[model samples]
Target: MRADVAFVNGAIWTGDPGRPWARSLCVTYGRVAALDDDRECAAAHETVDLGGRTVVPGFNDAHHHLALRGRRLATLDVGHAAAPTRDRLLGLVAHKARELAPDEWVRGGGFDQNRIGGFPTREELDAAGGGRPVLLSHVSEHIAVASTAALRAAGIADLRRPPDIPGGRIVLGADGAATGLLLENAKKWFDATLKPHRIDELVGFLDTASRTALAEGITSITDPGVGGLDGIGMGRADLHGYLTARERGSLGVRVTAMPYITTTHALAGLEPGVDGWGLDLGLRTGFGDEFLRLGAVKVLSDGSLIGRTSALHEPYCAHAPGEEPGRGMLAFDPERLAETLGLLHRSGWQLAVHAIGDRAVDLAVGHVEEAQRRHPRHDARHRIEHCGIASPEAVQRIARAGIVPVPQGRFLWELGDGFLDALGEQRSRSVYRMKSFLDAGVVLPGSSDTPVVDAHPMKGIHAMVNRRTAQGRLIGPQERLTVEQAVRAYTHGSAYAAGEEGIKGRIVPGLLADLAVLDADPFAVDPRDLADIAVVATVVGGRVVHGADALA
Candidate 1:
């Protein structure tokens, strides 16, 4: 049969050892035609030589934030510097201030209190910003540091809480004045009031993020939450943005968007199995031509770990005496969460709940299990996002419930020190326990949670295998997984979580042709050197999205 393109002279790891390696693959109409030999390719219409490079299935990031990633690129970056001190952060602010007009806001991201020693105050930010409104996000995206002008611009001159939202705190000084720190949803006040980006500009942002993900060997990503009354504004705008980018031939990676639960109310008016539900807008959890789709229903159960706002069973170790144990905030009351899950589960919509602390995880898992039992649906494939600080009991319950734990392995690499400090030794030791989850018979999918950390699968793999902190301390030596196990969690495990394992995870006949080419075999290298492996190329549906060079 005539083929559109064929890649030969390559070492392919198809994720299935039974048919582990292939010498060549044929492509037609943007799908895998066949895995064949040179003789088979000679019969094809076109052929290219790979020069014996290593090829594996394309990396699938189970968790990521596409819009935030693009915003980071255009904003000031304080997270890249090796040990960002006060002076270095100020330097970044000053540099950004010079580039913007006097009144324009200077937005920056990737600032961490752990790295910078402490949060920047309004006075400090004002000095660095040179009279412009400056707003810098914490590395976790759960907190922010804003100059006095920016706070004032958001109409937060005096410390006042919004009527309904709880668990969001605005740090105040001893003099009863507002500090620059905005925790949890309080950051949204400024984020929402900021100037909106044009549709063309937003599309450009998504294009840049997609190209970056492709270059890093990422072929697919699940954006957990988008759009709502919450400041993100991802609903119709994000839909149009992805559609525009795909039409312009600028999007190279597959995106599965999980719209926020607040938008679920809007979908209530629409009938189930509605044809072209966001499909014309380029959406479908299990649809599309594989480039973009809607994946799952995203719900937030609590706040963030770093912000000391995640709902937990025990008091935060860092909480001051007499302060309310710092038990954190719950995004939805138990009844509300259970009701939401019941509705989504009955509708056959897969759910991914963001539950960070052990208590929140337990609550979410229980709700899902109860929903499944009462509603009794098959192949629902519900997931607990973060699952970061679950106890052994919670882990067993999660496993028993048949829910997937989509943990961010990159957090171990970026926030290990802070985790240890806040959660103490015992709880911190179990953080990001990939092996424990697997051993308990729970499906564990690896993710980057990009914008929170660098979304490189290699780095995530290194953290999974090494489980070490930036200071080189072994945070959880017992929680480490082998190289092979880590790879499966990122690829096959993630596919399973998305209910696409049969068609996309393993490279075999009838599977999608999503693959990555590497400079070196990850299995052949020393465990400690896994992070050093370079991505030579990334191919999705037989198309070469990125490469070290064109095939010979």
Candidate 2:
């Protein structure tokens, strides 16, 4: 076959076991024709010399929020780096509030109360915002603090009778008033009442995010939670936003959309436990082409580990000196979870359940066990997102069941310290244990729960390899992975999570021609230097989609 594009003088990690390295490759019909094959069949094939650059399969983030992350990119940067301390965070937010009109929404996010000692109170926010309806989300997205004006705007005029949401909490002050902090499902009240973004408006943000992902050499992403609104106010259409971006000629990367099945009635009549899903669109898991498709049904089984909302088998260490220890609450009954999961499994849908704490992980595994016995479907490939706090027995079950764990490798770098503090030494020794998973024959795919941490695959790889926290403390020396193992998770591991390993993930003949050209070889570089390695170019579908002559 004639080649549409040919590459030579390159060091390519093919991700194939047999043909691991390739000096040259050819692409035709948006698929790899051959690796290191010499042929003169084409008279007009385009050839490019890679100048000894390293090529790897384009990264596929197994779990991330697409449009929502794009929206966060447009919002205020109240992250730890920006604020550093409580006073600085308040000042930054107040400064932003002063610029916006009082009637306008003054939304900000990425503020970590743990860094600032404790959650910011309503009075503190009120003093800074000058009557603006300011809201600052926690780094984990499981918690947030709102100004009094914002609380009123969100229909929370009284904390005394706050909305009774399942698996969520409204933090109240000693004065019997709302403290302005909302946790878990309580955050959804604000999310449901938060202002809505039109399809085009959301597309703008999605486009920006897509471009950013491509520039970073991320050719594909699985948005795990679409149609799951996390804000107050109703009518979220982020799933449609992807369609809008693709239709408007703005989509820059491949996307795998997973519609969240929630009881929030987030999507019209598509609530959890509901039948006749995708009847109108006529799509379910595995539907659509390579460009975009439905991958799994996302169901949150619990909250964040760092936020102390994730259900734990044992009581979590107290966050405050005097506060009682908490056994994190489960999001649903285990029996009901089994029934719902069985229905989805029998219906031929893939499952991506978020289970952070050990108990949540156990419940998620139990549900899968029940579902498998009820339906007995092979190759379900069910994924446990986070799968953070796994027990010894649960790890065995996960490996035996062959469930894919989509973990945030970046968490080892960013949240390892907090995890250590919360779980204590013995339990904390195994947080996000990559080595444990690999040792148990479990597939561990790398991902960043973006908006929670940096989404750079190299950064994630570095974390997995080093297990170094932000403060330069090595938390779990036992959980570290080798550079190659880490890279494999980011590429092939993620593809396995989405059932796209056959076409994508690997640079091999007959596979989709998705490659990322790096200026430095990851295999040869010092482990510490991985994150510093830059992506020189990105090619998808046999075409250079980013960098070099992409503009041409």
Q: Which ten residues in a row are the worst by lDDT in model 1?
A: 275-284
**Residue-wise lDDT of candidate 1 within 1-552, one digit each (tens)?**
677778888888877867878888887776677886566677777776778988878889999888668878877788847337878888878887988889998888887786777888888989989978889988878788888888788776455442233546677787767778887777755566763566687777788898899988888888887765464444446667778888998677888878777666424334555421222233335655466777887887887787677888888786456655477777777897788778777666788898998889889989998888888877678899998788888888888788899998878878888788778888888777688899998767879988889899999999999998888878878889988788888888888888878778767767788888888888888988988887888888877778736564
Which stretches of candidate 2 lie above 4 Å from their native place?
40-44, 230-236, 263-282, 549-552
* lDDT top scorer: 2
Q: Distance from true position, residue 176, model 2, in Å? A: 0.9
lDDT of each: 0.79, 0.81
Which ranges in model 1 have alpha carbons more than 4 Å from their true place? 80-83, 157-164, 229-236, 266-287, 319-325, 548-550
Per-residue lDDT tens digits for candidate 2, residues 472-520, read: 8777688889998998998998888899888888998888988898989
What residue pairs are clashing in model 1? 58-515, 284-294, 285-294
lDDT of 2 at 232: 22
RMSD of each: 3.0, 3.1
Provide the lDDT at 352 for model 1.
89
TM-score of each: 0.93, 0.94
